[model samples]
Target: MKAFLASLVVALVVAVGAAWLLETTYQSTAADAYATNGARVGDPGHNLVGTDWYSSRS
Candidate 1:
Protein backbone atom coordinates (compact mmCIF):
# COMPACT_ATOMS: atom_id res chain seq x y z
CA MET A 1 0.00 0.00 0.00
CA LYS A 2 0.89 3.67 0.02
CA ALA A 3 1.98 3.61 3.64
CA PHE A 4 4.43 0.79 3.04
CA LEU A 5 5.86 2.45 -0.01
CA ALA A 6 6.23 5.75 1.80
CA SER A 7 7.95 4.10 4.74
CA LEU A 8 10.33 2.29 2.43
CA VAL A 9 11.29 5.54 0.77
CA VAL A 10 11.80 7.22 4.12
CA ALA A 11 13.97 4.37 5.30
CA LEU A 12 16.09 4.50 2.17
CA VAL A 13 16.58 8.22 2.57
CA VAL A 14 17.57 7.85 6.21
CA ALA A 15 20.04 5.09 5.41
CA VAL A 16 21.68 7.07 2.63
CA GLY A 17 21.90 10.17 4.81
CA ALA A 18 23.45 8.22 7.66
CA ALA A 19 26.03 6.65 5.37
CA TRP A 20 26.99 10.03 3.96
CA LEU A 21 27.32 11.56 7.41
CA LEU A 22 29.50 8.73 8.67
CA GLU A 23 31.76 8.90 5.63
CA THR A 24 32.14 12.63 5.96
CA THR A 25 32.94 12.41 9.65
CA TYR A 26 35.52 9.70 9.06
CA GLN A 27 37.19 11.63 6.28
CA SER A 28 37.38 14.77 8.38
CA THR A 29 38.85 12.94 11.35
CA ALA A 30 41.36 11.10 9.19
CA ALA A 31 42.44 14.31 7.55
CA ASP A 32 43.00 15.92 10.91
CA ALA A 33 45.04 12.97 12.13
CA TYR A 34 47.15 12.88 8.99
CA ALA A 35 47.72 16.61 9.23
CA THR A 36 49.01 16.22 12.75
CA ASN A 37 50.89 12.90 12.44
CA GLY A 38 52.19 12.89 8.85
CA ALA A 39 51.39 9.25 7.94
CA ARG A 40 53.82 7.54 10.34
CA VAL A 41 50.92 5.79 12.02
CA GLY A 42 52.49 2.41 12.78
CA ASP A 43 55.76 0.55 12.78
CA PRO A 44 57.34 -0.65 9.56
CA GLY A 45 57.42 -4.28 8.51
CA HIS A 46 59.93 -6.35 10.50
CA ASN A 47 60.85 -9.36 8.35
CA LEU A 48 59.77 -8.27 4.93
CA VAL A 49 62.93 -9.24 3.02
CA GLY A 50 64.24 -11.98 5.31
CA THR A 51 64.57 -15.68 4.51
CA ASP A 52 61.68 -16.88 6.57
CA TRP A 53 59.82 -20.17 6.12
CA TYR A 54 57.52 -18.81 3.48
CA SER A 55 60.24 -16.92 1.62
CA SER A 56 62.61 -19.90 1.56
CA ARG A 57 60.17 -22.01 -0.47
CA SER A 58 61.43 -20.47 -3.66
Candidate 2:
Protein backbone atom coordinates (compact mmCIF):
# COMPACT_ATOMS: atom_id res chain seq x y z
CA MET A 1 0.00 0.00 0.00
CA LYS A 2 2.77 2.40 0.85
CA ALA A 3 4.58 1.60 -2.38
CA PHE A 4 1.39 2.07 -4.35
CA LEU A 5 0.85 5.49 -2.85
CA ALA A 6 4.38 6.51 -3.61
CA SER A 7 4.07 5.37 -7.17
CA LEU A 8 0.87 7.29 -7.58
CA VAL A 9 2.52 10.45 -6.39
CA VAL A 10 5.35 9.97 -8.84
CA ALA A 11 2.95 9.33 -11.65
CA LEU A 12 0.99 12.43 -10.87
CA VAL A 13 4.09 14.55 -10.87
CA VAL A 14 5.25 13.09 -14.17
CA ALA A 15 1.88 13.68 -15.76
CA VAL A 16 1.79 17.28 -14.69
CA GLY A 17 5.29 17.94 -15.97
CA ALA A 18 4.63 16.24 -19.29
CA ALA A 19 1.51 18.31 -19.76
CA TRP A 20 3.41 21.52 -19.13
CA LEU A 21 6.17 20.60 -21.54
CA LEU A 22 3.74 19.67 -24.26
CA GLU A 23 1.83 22.90 -23.87
CA THR A 24 4.92 25.01 -24.22
CA THR A 25 6.12 23.04 -27.21
CA TYR A 26 2.78 23.36 -28.96
CA GLN A 27 2.52 27.08 -28.31
CA SER A 28 5.97 27.68 -29.66
CA THR A 29 5.13 25.80 -32.85
CA ALA A 30 2.00 27.88 -33.43
CA ALA A 31 3.90 31.12 -32.97
CA ASP A 32 6.59 29.95 -35.33
CA ALA A 33 4.03 29.07 -37.94
CA TYR A 34 2.44 32.49 -37.74
CA ALA A 35 5.83 34.17 -37.99
CA THR A 36 6.82 32.08 -41.00
CA ASN A 37 3.65 33.12 -42.77
CA GLY A 38 4.55 36.79 -42.33
CA ALA A 39 1.00 38.11 -42.03
CA ARG A 40 -0.09 39.78 -38.85
CA VAL A 41 -2.11 37.55 -36.63
CA GLY A 42 -4.98 39.54 -35.22
CA ASP A 43 -5.87 39.65 -31.61
CA PRO A 44 -7.72 36.84 -30.11
CA GLY A 45 -6.02 38.57 -27.21
CA HIS A 46 -3.81 35.57 -26.31
CA ASN A 47 -1.90 32.85 -28.05
CA LEU A 48 -3.93 29.74 -28.68
CA VAL A 49 -0.82 27.70 -28.04
CA GLY A 50 2.54 29.53 -28.42
CA THR A 51 4.01 33.02 -28.35
CA ASP A 52 1.96 35.88 -29.76
CA TRP A 53 3.76 36.93 -32.89
CA TYR A 54 2.91 40.08 -34.80
CA SER A 55 3.63 39.53 -38.44
CA SER A 56 4.76 42.27 -40.78
CA ARG A 57 1.91 44.23 -42.22
CA SER A 58 1.75 45.80 -45.66
Best by lDDT: 2
- Give one digit per residue, the lDDT tens place, for model 2 in 1-58: 9999999999999999999988977555444568655767665446465565566895
How many backbone clashes does every candidate have?
0, 2
| TM-score against truth, every candidate | 0.46, 0.45
- Judge candidate 1 against the unseen true structure and give its global Cα lDDT, from 0 to 1: 0.69
- lDDT by residue (1-58, candidate 1, tens digit) is 9999999999999999999988977555433566545575443345346555464467
Give the poorly placed runs of model 1, Cα more than 4 Å off: 26-58
| TM-score: model 2 vs. ground truth | 0.45
Candidate 2's C-alpha runs over 4 A off are: 26-58
